[model samples]
Target: MNSTLLLKKLYKRNLQPVLTDLKFAIALLLIIALFSITGTVIEQGETLDFYEANYPLHPALFGFLSYKVILAIGLNHVYSTWWFLSILVLFGTSLIACTFSRQLPMLKVARRWSHYTRAKSFEKLPLSTALEGRSLDQLAPVLAQKGYRLFQTDDKLYARKGLVGRIGPIIVHASMILILLGAIGGALTGFVAQEMIPSGQTFAITNITEAGIWARPWLPKDWLVRVNRFWIDYTPGGTIDQFYSDLSVLDKDGNEVDRKTIHVNEPLRYKGVTLYQANWDVAAIRFQVNQSPIIQLPMTKLQDVNNKAKAWGTWLPTKPDLSAGVTLITPDLQGTFLIYGTDGQLMDTIRVGGSSEINGVTVKLKDVIGSTGLQIKADPGVPIVYAGFGLLMLGVVMSYVSYSQIWALQVGDRLYVGGKTNRAQVGFEAELLEIIDRMAGSTPSLSAV
Candidate 1:
């Protein structure tokens, strides 16, 4: 018995700090929010050179945040860091402690009733009224219609509504815990890889940019992805409208398993892996020289795509004299190129399936081959995350309900009624007046007819 008492005391002591001091939970929330912002601000899983070039040391970011600091603190990948996850775990622990130590017991207390055997007990309620020689039968149906549950005995009665409101906070806490578990599960098992494949090329997932420590077992090892075709649709004003890539999943024996035509926001999924069409590039241009064999020339972008206009250009030797060549430039994958002559003169604008004479030869533009940039991801916790979000929304709506209760007692020739509510003060008062009116307004006694 002494040992049991000691263990109980220790448990109570440990529980008091976590339950009484809410500051720790609040602080954890603020830190998580601040670091989530940092995750968005600082790019994740970038190369050392990328960080060095973008966040250089010569003029470090924000005066003190340098590449060295970011690397050392793991700011480059904050979401998966040990410290951030530890904070989430601590916050969840506090929630569990708070739920069991306070909320559950409070709910149990809320569900119980202390019958007012003495008249003084009825007098203490926030709303109470008395009528001599009356029965409150009419009050039962009215309260029941307002969602108040009814409990009764011979000379005493109790009714309450919106008990569900008491369960909302518990559900909210549980939902948050589920969300944290989902995030942790995803971090432990998710992997993200990138592949830029030209049309007609097949590749396996190898360029992993972001992944959890335990994600290797889940990575694709038996499957191959092929970009069967890629094309871009342009607006009338010569801007991109949309780009599409037709992808096919293949087995080890090269048999096709699945296929999809995907663009932005639309992704293809197979065997827990998802492929998103994130970017597109001009890979090569196909040209035909007037009944001669077709030649495909590789294209390269002229400048950084972000800083300058999107354009890819290639050179073609049109004259056997070896002194003259044509530079073909296209602003987009519109299959239209600005043909520049060897003398640096604007020769002509050529479109796919159109022919132009230059250097005593007819140059026909055939097609422009585009490449698709695919972001491949495998996350096993997506369903759990979705379920958590659903529960969170449900808990929020349920929390709005009011847990109102009414109690009544009878003595000699007097009926005394009283009520209380956990929320909506004005509404509860209105309910009191309404109940009093119903009891007084009834033609017969307030008991069952």
Candidate 2:
């Protein structure tokens, strides 16, 4: 008796109720969805300066949201936060627990057999009937036509259709578990970083924006990325039509391993790492002074309110006193520069490989070098997450199939029939009527016994 009471207590508290409670599952789903929405509406993983500039305290966003509040709550990196991860883990636990306790047990009940021995049992069913002179042989043929698996013992028989429906809940729970596992794996092992590499230069991954604590940073160790060239195409109105970056992957010994020219939305994947062309900027200018050695002049942003466009410029002196000089200005990396005279007038326009006289000094525009911004990422759980979603779709479709079941007993020429179903009650009722009509036809006599 003590063991029986203890077992009942365990079943109620630990084994059965916690796992099979629909309200508990619903609560977990709601919590997960709420947090997911929060994660989406807020930006993630930005610099301190960016947050400060965007989310100021004086006139805070929505009257209360500021950078200080965001940083304190770790909203900048929601996906990698401990609380968000804990929610995922708890939701996964609920799915796994529900799978074993509720779904599997329901499936077992669907598969198990129970022969109705008494006609009163048939009366207890949602739909039941008793008739004279109909046997199991008359009912089996009709049930078989409807695709039910049969089980029989002496005068009793059980039949069911759509056993696949019983597996649907299990599949749904299992797929959810897989999805949660994949998300956790990605959060633990993936990394995101960005780099800005100038044209004709090679780079390795060093600027990490956000990475999992357990992420392996030394990935693709033997490979390096080279930005061979960066250029942009312009429309007739001088608007940017497109930009491109020609990239190549090299090995440790400096052999070309892979190559591709990537644009916005196009990317290159090498050895589990993906590089996307995300941005572009002017790096420096190559200039020469009257056939002398090449002088690389680093360009600085022109903060002059005189020109209301994004432009870079550098000033080169022609006189020893630095009083008379020319300012070379470029709006883009299109190999074109606008030379401004000391009196702020356009002196001459120079193209790459072209020369012009500025303050009696022959000045040439060698090259306008540009930099390419690449966003790099490595994720290992994407495939598993995709598979989990596939299974989720399949399971939802299968769950709609309606698992209908029936039982019959022919005891000494008196027929008994009963039926039950989880879904599609109208369909199950129609099937029952057809079977009843067939049995009444085969026996040639019928009565409610």
On TM-score, the leading prediction is 2
Off by over 4 Å in 2: 1-20, 302-309, 317-324, 341-346, 437-449
Tens digit per residue, CA lDDT, model 2, 208-247? 8888877875356788898999988899888888889999
In order of appearance, the predictions have TM-scores of: 0.85, 0.88
Candidate 1, residue 210: Cα displacement in angstroms equals: 0.8
Instruction: Note the residue pairs that clash in candidate 2.
Output: none
Which residue ranges in model 1 land beyond 4 Å of their true spot?
Answer: 1-11, 14-16, 136-146, 253-255, 287-293, 304-310, 313-330, 337-365, 440-449
**RMSD of candidates 1 onward, in order:** 4.5, 3.9
Q: Please, what is the whole-model Cα lDDT of each candidate in the order they appear?
A: 0.84, 0.83
lDDT of 1 at 252: 95
